[model samples]
Target: MLVALDGVPVGSQDGTQLGTLIPVTHLRLPPASRMEFIVTGPSENVKSAQLITQAIVTGPNGDNDTARTLATLVAREEDDDSNVSRVPNVTGPPWTPRFAGLATAAVNTTRRLYFSENAAQTQFFITVAGQTPTVFSANNPPAVVTTQGSVEDWIIENRAQENHEFHFHQIHFLVRSQDNFAINGSQPVAAIQGQMMDMIEIPYWDGNPNHPYPSVTLRMDFRGPDVGDFVYHCHILNHEDQGMMAIIRVLPQP
Candidate 1:
């Protein structure tokens, strides 16, 4: 059976067919990836259109080689304006994203720190990845970055079965040491990496050469003039709409 989603063929369960998945990256650049697969033969009348642009954290489903859904944090309704600008403050040492990656849960339902495969709990602030309610719950939550000239190690984890190009709005990073390991263990010192992206390309959770998991190591550089509240998330349109999105507020120069 062909799983035609939004007019685009994603995949089939029979293991005899393939579909086109759009990779939207750098919102300004549109779709920049094209994958050709031998699915029942390449016939005419096939639509030549792009689907998504950037990274969408997704995993493999039970019966198909295709993806499941976009990984994201729940968004507030259009009419809701109470917590939109909310900014939760951190008093102690800034919580390192690497440390958050170490948070654990008792069961699949447990969303104490990091998210699991379970959909319902994935939105919770499991390991501190993005700006979550628990992390930024105040009215007009201040930017996580403090004074200007602040540079930090931002980890773009490919937990989804796919890979992603995590593009940033103002900074361009360098490739440090692309690697992979248990993303949910207590190893704050352990390094996690992938290809360095001026625009971080986060592969989907289900992405792999033969089950691809392209983890890139990047060194993000942030300074003055470009410091402000800007978006730093996936470039895929549909996935961005789902919840694969976030904002980063860079402090101004002193």
Candidate 2:
């Protein structure tokens, strides 16, 4: 499913003190998934406006496809005092977007992270090539081991029916791209590329070969005081408890 504004889907932010809602061109949501976003009215001059768009869903078998009117957005009035803006003095490094492909290409080490639900769909996993899948075990091996200061690109793939949120501890990462088969851009993907963020949403697969699978490309930042073993997992607490989490060991920079 997709929720868009002005023909463009908007992007959502991680749950923070000060929330932000950006008017985007497009955004996608997988089945049984949810996102929180704010939409601005079209124009006060028009009194009200409407958004006419369509949504496509797969049949029970996951083969047959159908499309219908997703929603009709209506403009609303806002409080006069709610239109205040303030810019805080931020310190440290400036946030910027790191383009997709370029981030992985510049780094020699790239980790491919794949996730899927068990046959029952009640459990999930993080699997790496040539390694046993990591489940919800304290003894499970680390997903990826790397040194601090080393730049790495993690291509995360979601092979499940429901959508998932990817989150990590300590440092933030740069989102290269978030695209699956059904929906792609809600915000300026290019602009958000280099910006620092700790969480991302991965859409669900529509089971369409032409659409490809839902995935997110990210550049992990390990250049901070955070050293030693940490964890990365689905932001959804229920999913994390169901084994949708993994450890990532960051050794001191060599």
Question: Which candidate tops TM-score?
Answer: 2
CA lDDT of 111 in candidate 2? Answer: 83
What candidate 2 gets wrong by more than 4 Å, as runs, is: 1-105, 183-191, 209-211
TM-score between model 1 and native: 0.41
Q: Across residues 231-252, which tens digit of lDDT does each residue of candidate 1 receive? A: 5444544344444444556667
Best by lDDT: 2
Superposed Cα deviation of residue 27, candidate 2 (Å): 7.7
lDDT at residue 123 of model 1 (Cα atoms): 33
Off by over 4 Å in 1: 1-143, 181-196, 204-214
Q: What is the lDDT, from 0 to 100, of the residue 57 in candidate 1?
A: 23
Alpha-carbon error at 97 in model 2, in Å?
A: 12
